[model samples]
Target: MGRAPCCDKANVKKGPWSPEEDSRLKDFIEKYGTGGNWIALPQKAGLKRCGKSCRLRWLNYLRPNIKHGDFSDDEDKIICSLFASIGSRWSIIAAQLPGRTDNDIKNYWNTKLKKKLMGMIPSTHRKPPPFPTIPLRTTPPPPSSSLSSLYNDCSPYYTSTNSLTGLESISAAPHNFLNTSTTTSLAINCSLLQTQDILLSPLQYYPVKDSLIMFGGDQASCSSSDGSCSQISYGKEIKQEDMGLHQSHMISNGFEENQRFMFDYGHNGSDHSLNTWSSTDLKPNGYLGNTALEYDLEEVKQLISSSSNGCNSFFFNDESKTQERALYY
Candidate 1:
């Protein structure tokens, strides 16, 4: 069955609000402050409008310090960045821009910002970019007696002294995945071979025993606080063929599907501009194909800038999954 309406439809004034109605809503809100219930606000304000309608009018139009008219370039960047990262969480996007409401941001995105971004890209190159190909270096496995021995030799960051059963065991205590204090030579060798060629999201950090454990995805990228030992961990089960497919799936399913707009800046020659920007501002030494080994505030600014230029892709689920293993650390 259909849910009942919040208010009576009959005898409620609709359409454009008159000056008198606007004045009453504004004055009532200014004096009484919505009385904490929008559904009961209309009658209290002596307006013939529906409570919902009155609320919309007051919030969108009559609210104090409400920003109207054109959106600034900075606001455009913030909206695009937040949208790319969080999808259509308009309220969260609105919070970043002062004097703007979720309704305003939504309307601007639908009518203006989306088109402005689309216009930045040439029409001929509108198709999705081919998935990035990362080449893995061939290195002889370290001379360890067995696979278990190798894992123990490489993973000095793990708090547990007992040998892990398998790759899945690493997942069981994902929190102790990287130790910042010590860098195992084997871990560096493994990291060098397993190239991180995609900038999927910002690098997130977790505090572990007076050290920081940096994580991005299943590929365990880490760096010490003192800027020593930038190493990433890869599961033994992950094959070269599987890495390509898995990274592609992570990009396609995790990000591309969430892109509300059809335009992709990565394909339309905008990557050069993005790369230039990141190189200059963020000082990211890695190539466009390689992900950043460390997180910086500047990288975030670059992400927002790239997003505004139409590179509408982002990383999610890093925080929740990290939190799940909080008990282990």
Candidate 2:
């Protein structure tokens, strides 16, 4: 059997409401309110209308502060954004738009707004960009003599995404890049975050000839105590006076004559812009950072010729699996 009607169809009026009917519904509601039950409101107001019909008339047209007509651009944006997030929940969308009825928004979305938005939509005619090009490997994968024998295992090196991509381009670098079987390179990069047992370590120190992939991220990039800094030139020949080194460390590096060793660096332990590798960032007392030991020119030649720990053939590591390891200071 079909369900019973809300109000007797024979007794109640249907179709468009007249001016008198709209006035009666509006006057009755404003003075007494809905009294919590819309189903009984029409009967109480002595109207030959369905309770649902009276309610719809009051909410959609007769209500105070009721808005009608074209929506504004800001309103269009709000509707679009809300619709994208929650979809066709007309009542919720209406709540955000002050004075707009849910039925009105529903009608607007269905008959006009939906079509307007569709008209504004961009066409999918243009093709997507092509994938990047990586060169094919000319040589086989690297050997098993990985970086543990080279740079001692360190934590992850934090660099920009582009730097990491550069390192991954070439997996196997030449072993002789280290200049030492025991890894005497200046730069070191490593990470312990991955689950894979295999790691990739690509290292190239100062005076490295191969020019393997370099990853650069300096924790000391902000070595200045103030608020500004500049990169010190790598491989730049600095005089002893300009170098920000401790007096003892310089003495250990070997001193030929007092004037020659300390002249390049400033005499007052000052890291002047002129004396600097052009670095203006100095501690209040004047120190950029502890520089690597500066070996005397004569002593370096003597060490190269010495049989023990001599500057001899270099080395490096290339493995099957690869991870990027780069150290920049």
TM-score of each: 0.42, 0.36
Candidate 1 regions exceeding 4 Å error are 120-329
lDDT of 1 by residue, 1-329 (tens): 99998788887888998888888888887777766677888888888788778777766677655678887654664465445444455654554555576788888887655544332222355552233322221453333223223222222221123332222212222242233223110110011111211112222223222222222223221211111113332122223333233235434543223321111111111222221211123113222223312322233333445545543343323443232122112
Over 154-270, each residue of candidate 2 has an lDDT whose tens digit, in order, gives 101111121112132112233333223332222221111000111222222232322222322121121111111222112323333323342333345432132112211222223
CA deviation > 4 Å runs, candidate 2: 120-329
- Local lDDT at 294 for model 1: 31
Clashing pairs counted in every model: 1, 12
